[model samples]
Target: MAHRFYVVSFGSLGTPDVVWAPVTDTAFQLDFEESLWCPKALINDVLTANRLRLRVASRHGWAWADGYGRAGVSTVRDRTPEETDLPARLIEGGARDGA
Candidate 1:
């Protein structure tokens, strides 16, 4: 059986929380309360494509969702960006001011 996937992002004032589950599952019988199901191949692709980006974001205290075959709650630190190699233009104006 093919596994479905979900990408849940915790809510914030600016961005609402979201659960990216399979829409085609009309029965909604998937057990996702404790864990999401992301396929192994896709997870590998994502990790390979975003390895550098993920590493840099980690340095800025950003958090990520659990990967394929993993189960856990996501977390992030609330703090101002002290420094970053990422361009300032990429960040929003408010974030630039330590918002």
Candidate 2:
């Protein structure tokens, strides 16, 4: 079996570039606090963990603990609708049409 680096992230490194070596490629994206967790030393062969749902405070809309989760698979914790900003197609336009 083989693995590929589709979306590289470096949370433990605190820098996304640290994961991408050779210092190549100009086109890229960078996010400081708003970025997602980057894998450090752990490597899942088939990928076991995935964000299933999000938790939010009942009093406010602050981001709750983004604890480990699985989409429609595991029930590690209760999920609130506000906790996930899971990207969805607002308008299902063709990719060629800049969707």
Candidate 3:
């Protein structure tokens, strides 16, 4: 198969209830893409809002979530622009301010 990477979306990315999938790979992983999300629509609005800020509530005591998954393809990695190089750059890591 092809290369793959996991996505943790905020706003409306894979926000449960399976609304929209602008960037279609599969129902396995999600992206940090604003275009691929709704930003204000979610199964539970509060959970959606919280996730948008990356506000995770871990069992370690900081983040929480209803569910999470891996994009079903092959593997998962960073596909960010500056963080990656290529014709392969199409799936480069998300743009980071540090770059």
Candidate 4:
């Protein structure tokens, strides 16, 4: 199957930003920390290994580890309703209308 360059942007888990390049783009590199580009095949390897759920965030897309994760997904108890509520001070304190 054909692969293309991918923007490996920041995930919430602190994965490094990179440009996953095709062999045609440059010689293959295994050292990720020293460079911003790596062979695109590396991405396929990682995604397969991690078994993450991937999805497009919007038309201009990004990936997350798991689409179904919500607050407290890993915890035994859900967060308190008060903990989840948006602070009234934030809303009242010079916040923009649409924001």
Write model 2 residue lDDT over 25-92, tens digit each, in one string.
12112211212332221244343322322322222112212222211111113322222231111012
- State the local distance difference test value for candidate 2: 0.22
**Highest TM-score against the true fold, candidate:** 3
Deviation from native of the Cα of residue 54 in model 1, angstroms: 3.2
Candidate rank order under lDDT: 3, 1, 4, 2
lDDT of 3 by residue, 17-93 (tens): 42222234453333333223334465445323223222221112121121233111123242321232321221232
lDDT, candidate 4, equals 0.24
Per-model lDDT = 0.26, 0.22, 0.28, 0.24
Q: Each prediction's Cα RMSD?
A: 14.2, 17.5, 13.4, 18.3
Provide the lowest-lDDT 10-residue window in model 3: 57-66
The alpha-carbon lDDT assigned to residue 35 of candidate 4 equals 31
Q: Which candidate leads in lDDT?
A: 3
Superposed model 2: Cα runs more than 4 Å off: 1-42, 50-54, 67-99
